[model samples]
Target: MEKYIQEDLDKKIILLTGPRQTGKTTLSKMLNPDYDYFNFDNPDDRLGLQEKSWDRSKKLVIFNELHKLKNWKSWLKGVYDTEGIPPSILVTGSAKLDTYRKVGDSLAGRFFQFRLHPLDLKEIHNFLNPGNLEAELDKLLFSGGFPEPFLNGTTRFYNRWKKSHLDIILKQDLIDLENVQQIIQIETLIQLLKHRVGSPISYASLSQDLQCSDKTVKRWLMILENMYIIFKVPPFHKNIARAIQKAPKFYFYDTGQVIGEQGIKLENTVACAIQKEIHFREDCFGETKKLFYLRNKDKKEIDFCTTSGDDPVLMVEVKWKDNSLSSNFEVFRKFFPQLKMVQVVKELKKEKTFPNGAEIRTAHNWLSTLTLP
Candidate 1:
């Protein structure tokens, strides 16, 4: 398997974070072939790293899932400060290292953070064939980009893999990372969230369903988000002060995970893949681009908003089936007259420029055209 060369390899310390089974460990091994590997998942390996913190060898070091340890940040800071920077350090984890609640003021400005999302269209194209976009999209949406399940090429195998993966994350990862007293509540919250994808999350409603307080619901949601089990995309509102502010649309990190757990149609699965690709691109390349969903008081919605600085470079509406532009486009054009609008369809004949000056393009073509600026 070809490793996607990350851009920030030369930085002092690189923290690679993503949801479980996104190939973080595999990528770390490939990044530093000569590094001494230590994973907290193994009791012996964890004990070794804890006992030998002062051994300042010059060889590269790769720490896997060490963020679960309470003193990991401080320990790494001491190791790096005393070792004189000869050994490059790479830390890979399933959760966001910076989001650990017990993390102290250490290792700041000493590391560059990079998030590794599941394989996108570009990465798959580079690895496989660039021309096989439709097949790749179909395979990725159905089987997901988790290396093991996708390679296995059977729905039963993928479903079993997803169940086992979810169990480990819920049972082991959460318990190791957080100091929660009610593990069952957190597990139930996660299961409930799978049904709320693409819907605005209400804290009060969630709290009521879980028989917990609003604050507890919020905290647990943050924990789940930090662990990359789920994430929220805020709505785009510039000048509209009265626009809805408290609610955010939620999505799982991987669409296949959601599909395997809940049954989503092929069309909805495709939409989720496209959404993940847009968000991943924006996050990986910051300042140059932004991705958000659009909503207004008049009950209009757009699937995605991609912008370059203040100017809206593109406004996109995704539909599973062939549908005409909703009146919402007219309202949006009234506000941002200069921005280009587009409609992305799962099934379309190439790209078409509508008579109303909007572009109608296949999702695969549009995603392939996007490049980091």
Candidate 2:
């Protein structure tokens, strides 16, 4: 994580944006603990910032939560345009700093944004080696990837952390961002989405279940997306026939929050794993990468499809314990001859290559091998 941040801070103003408690501030502070630091959320600190005093000798400065300020874009434009690069600037925030910073004046070329995903196999271990991956993989699945609980490694701690995390995302984060009359309703919608994890999401069914218009349900989902509580991937159909393209599958940003069975739980875990790689690519390296799933009108489906620009490059399927190739895997291989296929099964006893030369490996080993372009 430090390497990723350090790689960009030298050349561009850096914004560390991701879900809450994903260690954006912690990582930022580690870069230069001696640097001048300000948090916009703190009224007293902001008051100090209002004075615009500067330590002329300082080589680094950190501004946290400044995105909440109305004129942050304009203010940053001045600080950056005036100060130049003596004090290399770093901005940190939770929830959509990536989107919010672009709101007012265009700070377009001023900053390089890197999404700090929760701790994962690659971040935690020697990803290339991944020695003794089983224990680490189980711990990741049980504890989820947020810093505190992941470090504490206790069910009791995770339970408390999970409760408090939800409260903050809902009561503090969501309330700050949107003014909706139904807080409890949105909370219920979060739980409903938890159940819908690893399954195709039908907005109409969700709307009917919640007794709200389909549009309202869609809006709520969007709210969750913006808040970083959940993220989704769409269906893939670029060259497929009779493809199901409308539906999406949602996955929690933290897999530990899901109460589903292990099969679905691992599916969400894998989704988050792949997503971390995707974000690192798009956010850090400026790659045109995306995650999607494959399904057809005839009900054939694969768990995920990854793309580079308009072309499909990889297809994945998740099975609880099965090591054999799936039908949809072959379907995608036949349709897209160049697509790389990976089959992840938790109980895979050994890494194997299928007849078509696709790899089947344990989730832990496979996830550890992923890297950004």
Candidate 3:
């Protein structure tokens, strides 16, 4: 079960959205188990929704993949308005529905929106038992947070699951939602991005490498992000002159997709863990939290930063060994006095202090201790 599932359902309707295969459907079923669950993917459910034949008098109703319908907004509004509070409603779908559910005025203030993500370190490990931290990280890095593959726990099963997941997203979901015609180019871009993880994205360089225009490259990147295949965090803007502008470092939602190298997968794993913490704060408690990268014209960089608007709350850097703070981070701390500095590393160390007073800890300890409020 996900922490987001525990959020209070005070609104008339709740909209649950997230990347594909992140267990949105499973959670929805958990929410309204005894009620008649309607998934639009099923032909019978589609016909029922089209004809308004489903039981409206039920105490609770769950609409799965409801956003796929053309007039999902209008239909939802009609039902929500006419039915009042007798039949509580829950709407679940991929990230595709996230936009339609939030932007349209018809659904405004009517539903609470939440984004479900793949599993993270804290979800898999018992914080009380730090004894097996090494083994836990190895397993999570090898098998991504997606429930199916993570639970299977075998190389053969993981590979087969990854191929099937990508095929469905690249060949079907992208086509159905984005109406993207350059399937081959986008697919190539996604493959290339796997190598570019934990680094700043250069559209101009990618365009030249792929023999496509910069605009095309950016469009493909955006499409992949919308599909939740990847995510990007922009540079911090607290100090404009020192911070790099408009440059975002991308990370995959699932680290298992990164083929052989454990370094990038390690960084990507930490990124996802931090992302889960911040997004939960936003979706569950309505807090303004964001993740970002810190770098300046000097080329000195830190892996990740947590912020709320212009205020930098925490600065995080991921490392595989040593667990020692870098000089670049010392300079970053001197510059941003308000932000708390933390170094998350693969190797656990007795909370060591840097020359500039930064703290270092293992990824397992840092992630396991985080709470939304």
Candidate 4:
């Protein structure tokens, strides 16, 4: 990511956004030691931005939390159009920076965006090179992929950190980004969703449980999505509009936030991993890849699917201990034989492949080497 980010910094403004503690600031600073830094949350830095008073001699200038500025897109456009890029510009934010990219034509082609996510199997394998991948997987499942908690590797620290993490995002970030007066209700919604991971969410059901209208429930879900608290995976259907109208499954950005059985956690973790992989291709290679789940009216379901444009590429089923092949694989194969199918098992004694090209693979090994077509 650093290599690709560096390459883009030379030619365009780099907009890096992600969850609150996904190491955006740390990664930005590491890119250049002598870079000038400004935070919109700081009074002094805010004043400096208003005055355009940063040192231009530095090779890199990093603007932290710049999205908080009113009319920031026009402001940045003016800066880029007039001053040009001797000192490369890198903007970092916690919220979805791309959401505001469509506000106006102010920043049409001046920036390249990158979304940073929590650590996953492939990243741990590449960077940490863990001697025991299975143990690292255990740590990721238990403490989550956040830098601090995962590194601490202690139950007590994770518990304490988890409380403060939610408080800051819900109490501080939410208040800053939105005007919703129902913080408690939003928190309750998160709890309700935690237990329903890997299942389609019915807006009617959610509204009834929260004593709110369906429209309000949908608005709250969008708010949560923009804040990077959760992501939704819609069902796979050839008709795009019809697919969107169907109920979508939700998963948390933080795996530790899930409250359910081990199988649920494993599914959520795999979802995150696939999402990260998709984002990587879109960001670095300009590929058209998306994530989805397969379900029909008959209740036959597969855990995940990846598509290139409108064509399905891969189908995956996640299991904690069951090594037996999923019957749904054969069902889907009959329809889309060109798509690769695999059953990822956490406790498989041996990996095998069927004559039809479907496979049963060990979860840790397969995930560590996961890549898109």
Best by TM-score: 4
Q: Give the TM-score of candidate 4.
A: 0.98
What C-alpha lDDT does candidate 2 achieve relative to the native structure?
A: 0.81
Please report, in order, the local distance difference test score of every candidate based on alpha carbons: 0.70, 0.81, 0.76, 0.90
After best superposition, candidate 3 residue 350: deviation in angstroms?
3.8
lDDT for each residue of candidate 1 in 1-373, tens digit (9 for 90 to 100): 2232344554567788888988988878776566788888888888888796523463567788978877888877877677645566878899988887365557877776777777666666666665678776677777667777876768899888888988788788878888566878987887787677666788899999999898999899888888887776667777546434457766776667553332243333534455555555544544455556777777687766667776666677766556565566778888778767877676765667876688777766665554422
TM-score of each: 0.86, 0.93, 0.91, 0.98
- In terms of lDDT, model 4 sits at 0.90
Pairs that clash in candidate 4: none
- Tens-digit per-residue lDDT, 54-115, candidate 4: 99999899999887787788889889999999799999998888675535456878899999
Total clashing pairs for each candidate: 0, 0, 0, 0
After superposition, which runs of candidate 4 have C-alpha atoms over 4 Å from their true positions? 101-105
Number of the candidate with higher lDDT, 2 or 3: 2
lDDT of 3 by residue, 86-129 (tens): 56687887754655443344777777777888877687665335
Clashing pairs in 2: none
Please give the ranking of all candidate structures by lDDT, highest first, separated by commas. 4, 2, 3, 1
Q: Name the lDDT of candidate 3.
A: 0.76
